[model samples]
Target: MSDQIKFIVDSLNKEPFKKNYNLITFDSLGPMQLLQVLNDVLAEIDPKQDVDIREEMPEQTAKRMLNLLGILKYKPPGNATDMSTFRQGLVIGSKPVIYPVLHWLLQKSNELKKRAYLARFLIKLEVPSEFLQDETVADTNKQDISAMEEEKDQLMKRVERLKKRVETVQNHQRMLKIARQLRVEKEREEFLAQQKQEQKNQVSTESLYSGSQK
Candidate 1:
């Protein structure tokens, strides 16, 4: 049992509580309140263990220890193993800040290995409906943000494609304008050459008539 408890403690200590900053804040349990809960649980387990809960245990460690106690059916000195008494003790023994932490732990414990025992022990627990609702809202907001980011990326890609297409069209129009100017210049040159040929033909005819008359 001690080995199992030590393993559980080690596992709990290694959890990424700092990464779940929002969830921790949502629970709102202060350090001192968490310490008291840890001390109580530790005392229940072994009064002679000689470890100071406040000095040695971190908040995450305490929360995990409490979870283990609930799972292993470690009833306190005078309380029954039922959910109501357990919840009342958590609320009354600790400060108001402990409620959120307690709720969070209970919610998480339901998915743990010894969940059947925990479920039975905490069957009568009344989780705050608002907490669950707030968590859902948080999740939905994250999804919305992700979707908006995806849409923004797609819009940027489309804008880039349109820019390339517009540039291509402008290049085509410029080529056509240059072609038109060249065609007009060629037509003007052809007309001038025809006029010069006509003038030369008239001069030759006048000269030939004069020679025949002489």
Candidate 2:
């Protein structure tokens, strides 16, 4: 899965992360570096998540983070995979298993980042009457809501691109006679659907805020 590793490495080295990690290969990654990378990503995607995979991280802490990943509906690339297996590969930065997981995480990073922001927005989605009593606080919330709407527009454009790409890929795969490969494509289709739902949730949240504004 060199391609997967390349995508993760390229993404991590780019904006928001800019982690210029000198990695010749995934296998060359150490446990400390691996945990550091995981921590950085978790911070970006889910700021509310309290994860800190340190050099001497305990097993309980690692397992709890894995459970959080599970709650996020992360599926390892295998049938009925166990947490222990994921823990081992991830903790050691071993190849094959961890690469796919990391690839999936990076793929969802932008979407999750928005969701994390949406989560915070939802906390005060009602415009909280407490804040409404103060004109300054209400105005500040209005500004934040305006910024969120712009972000939602960008998210919609991205959703359009993903839909087009998925359509092209599905059409090409339909002609392929490989059942196994098609099954893999189906999983990606499901993931795209999940991302779409999250974006829809944000859109609906924005609508509620707009109505409250009026």
Candidate 3:
């Protein structure tokens, strides 16, 4: 026998609850408390076990705990109940290895069942914590919604500013183009006027000379 298994057996022998009941009695126990005890026992049991508990029939551990507590007596505990619906004369391994892990699992299941029962009772009373939780969740959701709206507003403002800036740049460019065109037109007009005045002076000089010749 490994020291770990011996440790579990010894611990349970001394536990206040187990001592209260000669055999295992779970009827008056709270679920959460029972689970804690089960976990404690399992902690002691795992190091001594030879098998990988995760690969084994996990449910059997639960069954064993309940059976040990005298809560589930209708069927025999452990893999025996799991493997055979009706006993066949043929047995696979004449002896099955009972590990501390299996027993620990059983203990945990019993504890969980008790806790579930307590939870149900608390729910029936409509405890304050339940309502408080709903309010907290609602407040959290509201904050998230408000934050999103604020971000959206900021993005919209930024877009509006960018649009205004683009419009101003476009307007300035249009004005500059128009000013250049007007300047070019004024220069062309001045050049044409100068040419016209020069032609008039030459014609006037030619007419005067012709008259003199006559």
Model 3 misplaced stretches (Cα beyond 4 Å): 1-170
Query: Candidate 2 or 3, higher lDDT?
Result: 2
Global lDDT of each model? 0.48, 0.65, 0.44
Model 2 Cα lDDT, one tens digit per residue, 7-114: 988988998888776458545777666766776777777774445566445554455445435434566665443545656675565566556767888999877666
Cα lDDT for residue 189, candidate 1: 99
What are the clashing pairs of model 1?
none
Cα-based RMSD of candidate 1:
29.0
List where candidate 2 sits over 4 angstroms from the true fold.
22-27, 49-52, 115-214
User: Rank order by lDDT, top first?
Assistant: 2, 1, 3
User: Which tens-of-lDDT digit does each residue in 27-140 have in candidate 1?
Assistant: 354656455544443443333323555565343343444444443344343323333444444434444334433334433443433443334334233333332233332343
Candidate 1 shows a clash count of 0
Candidate 1 weakest ten by summed lDDT: 123-132
- Candidate 2: clashing pairs of residues: none
For residue 19, model 1's alpha carbon misses the true position, in angstroms, by: 99
TM-score of each: 0.22, 0.48, 0.22
